[model samples]
Target: MLHVLFFCLCLRQVNGEFVDDEVKSVMEGDSVTLNSGLTEVIDEDLALWRFGAENTLIAVINVIVGSVTVYDDVLDERFRDRLKLDHQTGSLTITNISTLHTGEYQLQTNSVRKSFSVSVYASLSTPKISRDCSSTSSSSSSCSLLCSAVNVGHVTLSWYKGNSLLSSISVSDLSISLSLPLEVEYQDKNTYSCVINNPIRNRTTHLNNTQLCPPCPECGHCCDVTEAVIRLVISALVGVATVVVLAYDIRPRKDE
Candidate 1:
């Protein structure tokens, strides 16, 4: 009977002396607030927050005058200088959280260990096509269309002419741009479009011919078309720019 009474007293001392207020579901590069409310804070005891795979010690707030200890640690540089705690509110604030910083957390107060967990998820936005496309007919040889995406790098780009798949290009530069070779020469109007799709977003652009170029009359070699070539180049540039601008501008307003 005496042993049972002693055991009950020890359990009460352990449970009543310290309490754990945990946090959950923190996003990467963000912060989390953990609150340990009304936990007895004693001058003889220390409150500590530890994190990581190896259980490296993070921060320790000394409890004095029966008051809580406050600590702050930023979840940066592989959890170096990334964990923090506030004794006043018993809140553990972690900043700049990353995937590596996510795991089980153990809070030790005066030799008592309370375990909790934190999971960090990544927040990603869809990619945007920030450039434009243009097409023009050259009297010399063939028709060509120019398509580009701004601020995009190392992605695949696909071109289409009126629902027909033209080509697929792999881009390595930051600003994605491609010039498509045209095999068909039209004397009238042509509708051309380009579509760029990636893991994050898919963008489509429609380009219209700037001027009507009729075929050479009665076996003429070719239209000298020096001016026409220049005009076609200019038009292609403009079309690409417009598509990128419009795609960027209209996307944000819809999200709201």
Candidate 2:
């Protein structure tokens, strides 16, 4: 009869109402700890941890049985060798985490039930700036440019003119490319920069107007010079050929 009462109490604790979920954000390759919020678990208490929408069991601690299990082998080994459980508090720590680990985590204990929403973001890559050569024209005074980043996700690619934001583009998919375009005068001396950022971190690349958006080449003068050089070479070759022909005819005709 006493054992049955203890089992009933355990069931009530396990089925307790869960509190509001807490949100957590972490960078990729960093460690995050999902605190169980329990100071110390009693010997008669049971602590359980689950992950994802499927409620897959990832960890469990039954102090009464003196057993602690971490199911890191499940989920296609994604959590393999990465899960750590604090036996005292029933907290879970995921080391060297990636975006694949972003999900919902639940912890149930005899004292309280808690939920956490973990979001793992990839590190921001530096934005690259290049001239839009296709948009270049001798008559156009403005220089068209593109700033891009590859294999980035959950980031905003933005163009900033000094302290003001000029334009921006955002993406949420994984391992995708992002590009933002800006046009500025070739002689403009204003500071410009391209930035790629997430909620936690950002990367910035400054623009070098003189180097990237130099004044358009003088195509007309270049073509004219090239044409003149070609004509001069052709004329010289023709004159040489005529002189050789005349010398051969004048000197060799008598011998024939």
Candidate 3:
């Protein structure tokens, strides 16, 4: 009974040190390996792999019994057949991984115990840029523009002007959209770009001022021409009305 108590205390102490020693990020639909750092599993050694908050057993290797077991059928078969255990190193590899597999993974053996925090991120979409016509006011000299990304999560969306960051926003949720706004002078000729990035990859879309926010018609060009034409038509109608009034006054005075 004394020996049993001592063994239990030792086990608890070991478990207390099972904090996450490494963090890993992987893009969805890719494979990631959680290495055990073992050169070889000796004849008397036993290695075990567990996952998630429930600590469900997923894989086991016992060299003494000459057995290797993978409990992929458990946990609603979320893992299915995508688990691979290295015989020599006792490492575990997850193939064709998705967001559903994201969580903490624990590896335990006679000599070493470690934990890994894994984050799986979806592929980033290309950012889009458009003129915010509604936000543009006639009195404002700067053009209003918006950059957006849809169906993206765990990313940073930013606007850059000639390698300088103008604005940025980040999101931690899943499968959401983000939008950022920027104001630039309509006549300014400068390079601008929108970028969306995750830890593993990034996508960029360059801003096209000519296509999105073209220069307004010159002050003395189309607008001025339209105003001049309207004034000329109004003046001609007024002149014809004045001549008719004078002719009626001169002819009606003789009858009176």
Query: Residue 173 of model 3: what lDDT?
Result: 87
lDDT for each residue of candidate 1 in 18-62, tens digit (9 for 90 to 100): 444343665457776544443544532677766666665666666
Q: Highest TM-score among the candidates is held by which one?
A: 2
Stretches off by above 4 angstroms in model 3 are: 1-20, 138-141, 212-256
Which ranges in model 1 have alpha carbons more than 4 Å from their true place? 1-23, 64-77, 127-256
- Each candidate: how many clashes? 20, 0, 0
Q: Evaluate model 2: give its lDDT.
A: 0.82
Evaluated at residue 233, the lDDT of candidate 2 is 100
How does model 3 score by TM-score?
A: 0.73
Q: In candidate 2, what are the lDDT values of residues 1-256, reduced to their tens digit?
A: 0010010011222345537567777888888887777778874378989999999999999898889999998999999999999988888999988889999898888667778888888877799998766575545777688899999988999999999999999987876788888888768889999999888788999998568575435655788899999999999999999999999889877887
Could you tell me every candidate's TM-score relative to the true structure?
Answer: 0.37, 0.77, 0.73
Tens-digit lDDT track of model 3 for 80-183: 98999998889999988888899989998887887877888886778988777557555466777889999998899999999999999998887567999988
